[model samples]
Target: MRVMHVLKTVSKAAPTSLHRSASKTSTRGRKSPVQRATAGAITITHADRVVYPGESITKGDVAAYYQRVMTSLLPNVVKRPLSVIRCPEGARNTCFFQKHPMGGLHHVGTIELKEEKGSLATYMYAKNASSILELVQFGAMEFHVWSTRIDRLETTDRVVFDLDPSPRVTWERIVAAARLLKVQLDELELTSFVRTSGGKGLHVVLPVNPACSWDLVKDFSHAIATRMATGQPQEFVDTASKTKRAGKIYVDYLRNTRGATSIANYSLRTRKNAPVATPLRWEELSKIEGGDAFTIRSLPRRLSRLRKDPWENIDSVKQTLSAAMKKLEVGA
Candidate 1:
């Protein structure tokens, strides 16, 4: 009877061992191509250390970096699908990704190409490295890359509001600018999003319908800037000179270039590893300290309390650039 019991126990153990082996095999096979590539080639010595070389980076390295960083920095944003574009040859690399999380250090998704004409090293060194380091050490990694071919996306029209206050510009002036833009957009029935530039200004963005052309988008932006300037000439600076810009707000429409890309909303910037541009409600602008209150370090926690997403109804609001321009021409 004892011998019979031992045999039964051995038989049960064999099935369990077989099951475990099969499970492991299945997991190994299910990993995406990018995951497999990352596992085989990339090595992380410290969380915040990143090496940007003069040589070309392989697709595998890019994939691995994206996977690792996005997993942490972009956990919430990744619920949506993503695409990766290769950095073109001769493009200036004005940014670096941090390897570790530290002072406001967080994972970043996009990199700035800088001035369309600079050496890779020149571009890399141009950004605020201290800020970038902070983000890598402390922020999440949900990073992505874009190539010149990114225009292929259905959405070609981009509306950027370049914002900056005059030297010695008070915080109240900045808040007033935001409120004016918000009210104007609301009047037009167009949806818009707001973010601090991580500097002296605030950027107000509007997503255009994929059908719009670049020219139409530029014209619409010009109209808005002109209108804002006319409404508040004293507070809104539209002059081209730095000296004249004192006590005024500049409504920049130049960010609509073919190769231009705005820092991703909520993306952590390499400069000072400051948190990427943050989405803000109009009301918060009045309460928060303009320069000191926002940074790459504090954005994650601030995002947790937001009940409504600024771009939640983006699909419904997408409109043709021509249509938008026509409306703006009529001062709609």
Candidate 2:
């Protein structure tokens, strides 16, 4: 977690030129991959390295999966810095979190930032497919990206309502809770997209116009989450206390703030099932039974028919938190 803090601090202190640098560079800088090369390509050693046992999945296969879904998932990951869960051995063995800039990966960009405490550190951010492949070469199995890009560090592009349930809760109850929260958000005139959390929950993501600061968005998120818990006492909660959950779902709104990450859509998990974080239509929520319904093995086939990613048009729509804040302030 200390290293992750270094990157988080660096993310905030990133120079304004970093934004322009992020833009002027090629979105798909084409070149071959090298282990320590400066750019263009990457090499995946331990191609057969297994992360999930009994599944026959390999590090190389996972890289290929990311390549396959790059067109669908790149928009969400390309510009953002990742907090990686790397398992140099394998998923079942000891794994650690990474936020510090790696030294020997091609196309992987770094920003050396000064901390408020008066110290300097470097952080890493990805700009293209090769950047991801480079990380994979290091045995990264789970990738958690921040809410905004390195260029617009303070402005969140999306507000996330990460929904979690107690062990006693069922899918129907989860669906009921998600719909209830969406109705409230709808009244605020916000359009939200949903994703299977790739774990034990659902995440309602709202792409917004990036005008508000992290503080403003965090306050709004906190207020709305609290309202859902207090307003619908029987259906939802906002506390971290499990005993107080009372079988209600948690409307986790903290993902709206800075230095926090939500698993990227189409990303994979290290869990036994190799479950995937998947985007979905608003109408598909009720039909989902479990997060593992879509696993790594089944995803390749699913991709063949998905002409467009459910989130492909997300960046095209820009929303602001001002009105949503106003509506929440009025107790609407």
The top-ranked prediction according to lDDT is 2
**Per-model C-alpha lDDT, please?**
0.46, 0.73
Please estimate how well model 2 matches the true structure, expressed as its whole-model Cα lDDT: 0.73
Worst 10 residues of 2 by lDDT: 12-21
Per-model TM-score on C-alpha atoms: 0.57, 0.84
List candidate 2 stretches off by more than 4 Å. Answer: 1-40, 113-120
TM-score of 2: 0.84
Off by over 4 Å in 1: 1-42, 46-157, 270-275, 321-324
Candidate 1 lDDT, 106-202, residue by residue in tens: 2322332333464221111102222222222222232321211222432343477868887788877787787788788777777776777766678
Backbone atom clashes (below 3 Å) for every candidate: 47, 5
Candidate 1 weakest lDDT stretch, 10 residues: 4-13
lDDT of 1 at 87: 22
